[model samples]
Target: MSASDIRAEARRVLGICDACGYCNGFCDLFEAARRRSALTDADLAHLANLCHACRNCFQACQYAPPHVFAVNVPRTLARMRHQSYLDHVWPQTFAPLLNHPVATVIGVTLGAILLLFALVLAFAPAGGGLAIETGATAGAFYRVLPWTLMVGLGVLPLGWSALAIGLGWRRYWGLTRPRRATTGEARRRWCAWRTTLADILNLRNLRGGGVGCNDLDARFSPWRRWLHQTLLGGLGLSFAATLAATFYHHGLGLQAPYPLLSPPVLLGTLGGIALMIASLGLGWLEWRTAPEPIASESRRLDQAFLGLLLAVAGSGLALLLWRATPAMASLLVVHLGTVLAFFMLLPYSKFVHAGYRAIALRCESLDPVSID
Candidate 1:
């Protein structure tokens, strides 16, 4: 069935599971679901984002497939999570990203890189090839491609990504209909918020309720959790590196090509290492994961995003190692290309999972669980 059918199908499945209350402790999704009398489209969407696809409930369920209930929380929620991207994407025309998956990302990234190289060749001074070295000093990157051109190309897509995520968040938060709380309820919710924050940070749900998640089968493993955290840590560190570089340029009057011990170099080195490790590890996990419980359609998308991340991290690290040599010029172009592509696709890709899941966790925090 098409993605549009997700809401209806999920409603049916969740309706049955909610009544049974058999899988209440499987993860936060079931716990959140238990508090509600009826699951609406918005509620299901929020709940779907909260799911980590640990597959505990799917394995534990007695009414799966052959039974009339046919409750598959992981599969149904995965589809709904994907549909959220389609429904909330910016510029509407670009929403087709959900259809093309991996090919589009790879093609766009490569094309952008080639176009940039062409531009560099066309605009460089006579007898200079991308890199220009003055008498005793190192060849600074800006001499190859000026800051104006770099920022001009980057700002547009980055701005659009920020706008799209902001709008998508507004749409998602509006749908959840978080209630206004009294002081007593607010206090309890504040405590719940602390708990939810910890869960999100640690990905407690992927721990298979404690032992670990079922990656390929009923067997539990924490490898997926560690790999994902590594990716998260890498992304954060890379951003910090960029921010440090920006401050060095604008605030401190220092320029590009800082020392190895400097903030930018140190942060970028650590971040790049983490990113490479996580991207490769996650790509391997995706390759080995079975198609049964997990959503099959997301496989290509996941791989494409991970591929771009790997390219970015690898190229950045290479640029660092070869900065003193002639190779830095080409490495810079490759890194910029991959990074631009990643920022452009962030809103439409699986990258949005972090933001959407955070919103879902906040909503679940405010929700009160009733006891008999």
Candidate 2:
């Protein structure tokens, strides 16, 4: 459907939902909807982000399929949420990547790996073995891939991704941020920030009206919530590990190949294991989920994001295991390539949902009715 049709459909469904009021207690989205007499594109986008796709309302909906109304809130909002991502995307040129995310992700990953392989073949010493076996010395990693080259590879993509995501966040805020003037605006915003952070950290909405997400079947299950928490936690730890490594390298004048007991190594190891498990589990859940409640268009994008996480986590763990072996150099190249692709595509992929959702949650908390 065209963008206008999608918005029109969403408005129709939400209008019915507002009149019914059966789902007001299901999620914060319903409350937000109740307050809106008419939904603009911006309001629809905000509501889309507010929905966690828990499918609770879908299951409880009496006007669902087989009925004349055929109200399918989850599916409609899912499409709208995706459209919002495209609408607010930074640089505008990258929006097309969202249309074929899986292909884009795979192509970028393979291209990076191939380029890394070519660089290795062209630059490594003539007699260096397949492993490019740099001894387990302080600067062994740099021996295979120079520190300068590694820094360039990591920094450039990450810097661009940050800029893109930041700009997109700004645009979304401009579109959906609450405009009502109120007394104690600063205090209310501070409270909203705190409430939103707590909600995001715990994924309060995924609880599906105090039970759990109806992820795979009609039955409520905590599996989705657990997997989401694990993924978010794992990513957090992994980022923390990177920051720790940076501190050790630049602040303390220490090099990598840090001891197993060191903060970076320990954090990264735990994070990698969690990421692998969560990525695999989430993929399985997605595969088994009932198709009726999801946006068909988003399946590829979801899978592509999960695949990138799995590749990064799996390759990093493999590199750590085989760092001293003949496979170390090959694994290193694959790991770095996957990381590069992940960062480069992050802003254009499902990863942007986290930022958008956080903003939505904060906006919801800012509503007068939401305050305790």
lDDT of each: 0.79, 0.88
- In the range 1-372, model 1's lDDT, one tens digit per residue, is 675578888888888887888888768887777666566667777888889888888888898766787778888888888887777776678878866768778888998898778867876555444665431133367666667777877888899889987887787777774755445666787887897789788998888778888877777889889988999999899899989988998899887788899998899999999999999998988888766667766676688888888988998888888777777678778878888888888887778778788888877776644211
- Candidate 1 residue runs with Cα over 4 Å from true position: 65-69, 125-139, 180-192, 369-372
Per-model TM-score versus the true fold: 0.91, 0.95
User: Mind giving the per-residue lDDT tens digits that candidate 2 earns over 1-372?
Assistant: 889999999999999999999989878899888787668888899999999999999999999998899899999999999899889898998899998998999999999988877877766655442456664456666656777788898999999999999999999988888777666778877888899999998899999899999989899999988999999989999999999999999999888778878999899999999999999999999999999889877877889999999999999999888787778778888998999899899899989999999999987888733221
Task: Output the lDDT of residue 77, model 1.
Answer: 85
Best by TM-score: 2
- lDDT, candidate 1, equals 0.79
Q: Model 1 TM-score?
A: 0.91
